[model samples]
Target chain A: MTRDAIILAAIAGAGLLTVLLFAAGADGAPRAIAALLFLLIGPGLACVRLLRLDDPLTELALAVAVSLALETIVATALLATGSWSAGAALAALVAITLAAVAAGFARARGAGSPRA
Target chain B: MAAGVPGPARESAGQAVSSSPGPAALAMAWPVGRAPSWLLTLAPLLAALALWLAAIPAIDPDQMTDLGLIAVLPPAFYLALGLLILGFCALLGRERAGDWEPGAYIAAWIVILHGTPAIVYGSLRYAWAWKHVGIVDYIQRTGGIDPAIGYLPIYHNWPGFFGAAALLTEAAGLADALPLATWSPPFFELLFAAALLLVLRAVTGDRRLAWLGVWFFTLTNWVGQDYFSPQAITYALYLAAIGLCLWAFPARMPLAASPVGRVVIRGALLRRLAADFDRRAEWAGAASSALPDLSTVQRRGLLAMTLALLASIAVSHQLTPIVTILALFALVLLGQCRAWGLPLVMLLFTAGWMATGASSFAAEGIREVLSTLGRANENIDSNLIDASLFTPGFRIVSNAARALTAGVGLLATLGWLRRFHDGYLDLPLTLLWLAPVALLGMSSYGGEILFRVYFFALPAMAFFLAALFAPRSWRRGAASLIVVALASVVLAAGFLVAYYGHERSNYFRPGEIAAADYLARNAPAGSLIVEGSPNYPSRYHRYEQFVYVPLVAWPRGNVEASANAYSLADIEQMMADRHYAAAYLIITESQKVEMSVPGLASLEAIQGEIEASGDFAVLFRNDAATIYGLAGRQGAEP
Candidate 1:
């Protein structure tokens, strides 16, 4: 698989695993690590992969920064609106991640190459 | 633009076309010619890690003198640090050294430098870090923010970091944010390295210079702002935003095309002094051609990401957004960046946030903040605690920190001049390096504005510091490598003393933590907790439940008043107030160490006086701490 394909696959897998773990009411290192990886990189990778930044370090750095910013905005808005719920926040983030991933895939397909 | 070479200096040295090691590789043939470059780097890193782990338990914090942790740290720790520095220098001088090797070396350097204190110190190091953790705890417990809270209202007003931390802590199923606070130094230092790489790569293709810059940043960043706080996160975002702007947004138009550009170009001496490379006729073609090859959609996406990072910084920190605004304006003014609208957007975000979320804090402090404007000397004086009050060992440590800062400044000046003389218009880096100085005239920030200025300028300063090692000729490559290595070792020595020397007061004991925890669990809401000083871990739980009053006051630029002597009568008078339902006085070893200055009554003397008065009884006592309350108050009994 190309690097793009591998990253997309990891995101999808991690996203699914995080949701399942949350549903199962798991509360330990496994659940925490999975949630951390998903939150820190899944949405960011889905967003930044569209930019086509090839450098690993820059990509990783931007991904983390974007991810943290997204989390802050989502959490802040929820708290400010008086509708705070960790599960709801996580669900909203996961929804955003999936939406971005779908958009990335659609853009790649529209370019007439699945590998692009 | 430089064809992926490191610098124009390397180009002048006749090795611009190749990435091979120069004469320096042959100089090491007698010792380790047969070893692979990765092994050469990783072996020392691993050995250092092993040695450092072994050395941590050997360190006894009680043995630490005024020189801080350096006095108590085993010699093995020093050996480990030396090995890492020498190994990185070797890797940098080797034949066909890849990014992974030197990157790993620098990573190991941070792990050793920042991680040692993290692992050895059983609890969090700084009092401020514990206070931040309390903010996170508040958010998690309340599930909301109280911007007008009596305690830590400023944090509540700008609670982005605390809110995000709360979400992560709950998601991770952690009970508290203490672990995050414990490992924050290394985590933030690593984040800084990544962000700095983006900034450096955007400026120069020289991998050697970029890596060395990161290394130098790690060694010289003795400012201690990397504790688990909003500053750490916002600073990372600040660097990332600048790096993204520089890498992707070079100004597209020539200097003569714009009005400001035309005015700058019309002045001969001003043009030479600015020396903006894009304005040069010869470099104009390459500068325009070197812009990142991204589609319009991608560029817009990147721009959105940059704005998001900026918005994050705006909401999270009070000072970084201003620094970001100044830096972006500098970049645009020098024609180094094309994002002319970025500073304006940043201004909007800052002003909007202040008008809304942070308005409470701004409203209360606006007058005081305005009064400090243009008071540069007073602002700078706030950052300097009274050096005369320090013990002899700490005085040396303080001087070493000053010397290190001065050395970096001196070397950076030389490096800037050399780059300018070589026909390289390094005006962007120079402007960025000087941009944070603007804040020195803005506010004293509780005597920390000067340190914050140093922290923000360090990335640019580290770049110039690395420029000193960019060899002028291949024949000097070996000599350059040696000089770089020696410089790093000397800085690392100073860094140890400057960064770790204050562990005597910074490091908290388990007994001290226990006393604080006891007070946290037992103290009633609206009770009064009299503290010896604000330098110990005081507010990690139920912090808002009680009022905290420190005996030693730290007013603006009043070091003498900060060491005021407190008597038993004064305490009785203060605690006897009928307004508070109950009151207790707590003293700890860390507070004693911190308040050991002249003119301050020792915590022990106060304890003895209280014990003799027979009006207050000891609620709790440990080797490292004691908590006392009025003899007749039922709430005082623990």
Candidate 2:
């Protein structure tokens, strides 16, 4: 598979697993591992990889920062709107992640080449 | 060969002349061209880890001296750190040490430095961290912020970090945020190192200098702000955003021609100080030209990323966004950053947040905030922290911290001059270093503005500190190696003393945790929790359910004279207040250490007074803490 496909697959797989785990009310190590990895970097990485910033460390750092930004914004919005739900927040993040991946793939397909 | 040539030159000359080499020559020559193998270099790292693991169990927190953890930490711990430093330097000295080797070493250094406290304590160290945990717990429980909450209203006003933490905590299926808080120091330190690398690489094209800058940053950062707090996350974001600005937006305009640049250049002292401005201008232009031209799409992506970082920072921290604005403005004014509109955008976000989301805090604290404006000298003086009030050991720790700060500053000055003489004038770095100093004139930040300034300045200062020992060649000489190693060791020692030296008051024993847990579980809503000092681990769970009354708050200056002059009757009367459903007074070891300063009754003395008074009953007693309640009050004892 292409690098892009592999990245999208990982993000999608993790996001789905996170949603499922939360849905199942799973706790402890399994839930912790899946949720932390996805929440920490999944959504942000999905978006940042499309930027095609090849420097690994910079990419990783920005991914974490962006993930945190998205999480904070989503959570804060839910909070300020007085409709706070961890499940809802997680669902929003997963939706954002999948949407970002799809958008990146479509953009790449439209350009007829991967981003440099 | 010249007679006066250095030994390194002579060795190279001799090798060049010899056509046929002996075993010794082959042995010596073989490794010269090859970097050390991964196994050989990683061995020290493994050994260091082993030593640290071995040393962990031997430590007893009870035996900790005023020197803090350094007083009780086994020599193996120090040796482990030394080995890590030596291993890094050895790899760094090699001609072909690639990114992976140095990077791994720095990561290990951070683990050894920041992770040690977490491992040893096996609990969260700082009271502020616990308070942050409480905020997260509150958010997780309530699912919304209460901006007008009586306790910790400031945190409610700016709840980005807590909100994100709450999401992670609930999502991760954790019981509470205690574990997250426990390991946050190293997590944030690692992030800071990554962000610092981005910023350093943006300015200097030298890869080795950039890496060394990161290493120096790890060693010299003794400010201890890399805990579980909003400042830690926002500081990292600030660095990343500035890095993005520097890399993506090098100014096209000449520095001397900009309005602020003109004023800076026209100053007689600055003119005299930087007589090499002509050369600096030429070098800066060359550097800016050397930066790769980014495509429009990439620039847009980077700008979006910068905006995201800035927006998060604006909401997450009150102080970092302001300092970030100052930095961006300085960068623009000095013609180092071409993104003139970015600072204005950051200001708008910050001001917008202050006007809307944080209006409650702004409204309440605006007068106090305005009072500190332009009182730069008083703000700086607020950080003096009278060591005379505490134990002599803290005096030593405080002095060591001051000395290290001064030492880094002095070395940075020398390095800047040396780099300037070598035809590299780091104007952007100089401005970055000076930008946070403007904060000194803004607010004292409750006597901590100075340390925060030091924290922000240390990145650029680390760059210059590394430049002081920056290798003249790809392969460093033995003399330079020894100097760098020794300097690192000295800085690391100072770091241990300065960063971990206050563990006597910061660490909470298991018994203390148990007492706190008991209170959280048993104390009903609206219960009054009277604490000896606000230094212990309280309010981590069900924090808002009770009214907390601490005898002495920080600054200890605003405390009424009656509080200090409390008799047994006064203590009884305070805890036995009729209005509250129940009242409990608890004191812990950490509070005793904090309250041992002059003019305050020691917690032990207060405990004795309470026990002597027959009206109060002992509800809970542990080796590390004690809780007391009114003897005959209904529902007082669980």
Query: Considering only chain B, what TM-score does candidate 2 achieve?
Result: 0.90
| Model 2 per-residue lDDT tens digits across residues B400-458 | 88888889999999988777766666777888999999988876445556677888999
RMSD of 1: 4.0
Task: Give me the runs in candidate 2 sitting further than 4 Å from their true place.
Answer: A108-116, B1-36, B262-278, B284-292, B365-383, B445-447, B555-565
lDDT of 1 by residue, B1-638 (tens): 44432334442123323222322343355476566645544777788888888888998877888888889888898888887877777666554566777778778888887887788877888887888899888877777888788767767777778877877777767789898788888988988998898887777656677788888999999878788888888988899899889888865455455446766676777566444554332232243232357667777888998998898887787777889999998878656688889989999998888888888778867545333321222113322667786678867887887888788888888887776555455556677899999988786555556566787899999988888765654334666777887899899888888888777888899999999998888887778888887778888887888877777654342321232437777888767776776889999998888767555557778778888999998888898999999888766766
Best by lDDT: 2
lDDT of model 1 at residue B405?
Answer: 79
Predicted complexes: DockQ each: 0.57, 0.69
User: Worst ten-residue run, lDDT, model 1 chain B?
Assistant: B374-383
Q: A1-116 in candidate 2: lDDT tens per residue?
A: 67877888899899999999889999789999999999989988988887777677777888888888888888877776678888999999999999989988777678855444
Q: What is the TM-score of chain A, computed separately for every candidate? A: 0.89, 0.92
For model 2 the local lDDT of residue B528 reads 85
In Å, residue B370's CA in model 2 sits off its true spot by 7.6
